[model samples]
Target chain A: MTIREIGDLLDARVLCGKDLDVDVKSACGSDMMSDVLAFVKHRAALLTGLVNPQVIRTAEMMDMLCVVFVRDKTPTIDMIELAEESGIAVLATSKRMYEACGILYANGLKGNGELHG
Target chain B: MGESLAFHYEVDGGDFTSAGQASVKIKKNLRQLGVDAETIRRVSIAMYEGEINMVIHANGGNADVIVDDTGVTIILADKGPGIADTEKAMEEGYSTAPDNVRSLGFGAGMGLPNMKRYTDDMKIESVLGEGTTITMKVNF
Candidate 1:
């Protein structure tokens, strides 16, 4: 699905890189960047509640197309700027973590396949 | 691009927020060099994990990236409390990082393992109370 669809499905607000709405696909939700990195598949978007700059760095390193912040958590200017620089889209949603993940999952975005080794 | 390109960075352990800057730059540089996306991702992820380890474990360190027609090589050297057991440290779930580091979403004992996972080849050398150096390669 496109990032735009993800936003509509999760009730997410686009924070940056709105131009990239068409390129992203799949989605992974996790606060742990390491876990996200551990399970690298074809997923192109990361949905996370974590707000640190490392989140952007992690997305950049993983070649993810975007990041979605759950529970209406706002990203700092630094985070938005980093996402802009890295060419990764950013979105924030008011839905709680579980519900947001559930909505996306129900809409055909798998966790890029199972969670562990 | 027949000639090898080398980039060096000094990892500042003083700031956690700045830990992955080197890897970010390297990723950008690799992209500019027209490297494939998969190779670039592998090289950056491995190097970023090593850079984070240097900041969290050793105070700070030095990283060097050498790119050529053959492969990309990342050399990370740090002068901090060295690993006591290289074998155990290589394990997927073993970590020496403090609790605070965990809050930052790392130190889950996956750093070294992830490094190994992303790189085509890796080697670790350490001296207790002295320092450690890791060499990893990702072929293009």
Candidate 2:
């Protein structure tokens, strides 16, 4: 799915990088940034309820195309600016984490599979 | 490759909000310096994890990124309480962070592991009470 589609599916508001129109194959939902770094692969949009600069940094380090904040969490101006600087799209949604993940999964965004050493 | 390009950042402890700023700056610098995206990503992730560890465990620290023809090295130094056991710290699920740190989406015991996973070379130096320094390298 594209960034645009994911935003629409989640009914999320684009907080930054609204110009981005990239396609993301998979999505991962987690509040833990470490888990995302250690295990996630081939996922583009990070579905998270956690709001912090590290969330944006994690997506940037992993080369993720977008970060979607779930459950109506408010991102500070710092976060929006950082996402803009990193060229990462940011979306905020009222959907809960599980519901957002389900919507994306039902819409055909699946994890690429396990990552091995 | 006439000289090594070096970047220095002093991580401020007690400021959880400012964590990862150095990594972000280094990532941008490397990008503009013409480093490949993949190598930049690896270095960024490695250094980011280090920065998080420094803030969460050490209260704050220093991070340096040195770049040369063959590789990039990140040196993180902190005077916080040193690791009691290197072997246990290296484990995938071993962490000593407090509950507050966990609520912030970190302290999952994957910081060190993630640092090692994304880099080509990694070494940790610690003195039970003195401090800890982590050095990581990612080769082109």
Residue pairs clashing in model 1 are none
List where candidate 1 sits over 4 angstroms from the true fold.
A113-117
* Alpha-carbon deviation at B128 in model 2, angstroms: 1.4
lDDT of each candidate versus the true structure = 0.88, 0.87
lDDT for model 2: 0.87
Q: What TM-score would each prediction reach against the true structure?
A: 0.95, 0.94
Tell me how far the alpha carbon of residue B49 in candidate 1 is from the true structure, in angstroms, after superposition: 0.4
Residue-level lDDT of model 2, residues B106-125, one tens digit each, is 99899898888888889999
lDDT of 1 by residue, B13-94 (tens): 9999888999999988999999998899889889999999999999999999999989999999999999999999999889
Best by DockQ: 2
Error of 1 at B117 (Å): 0.4
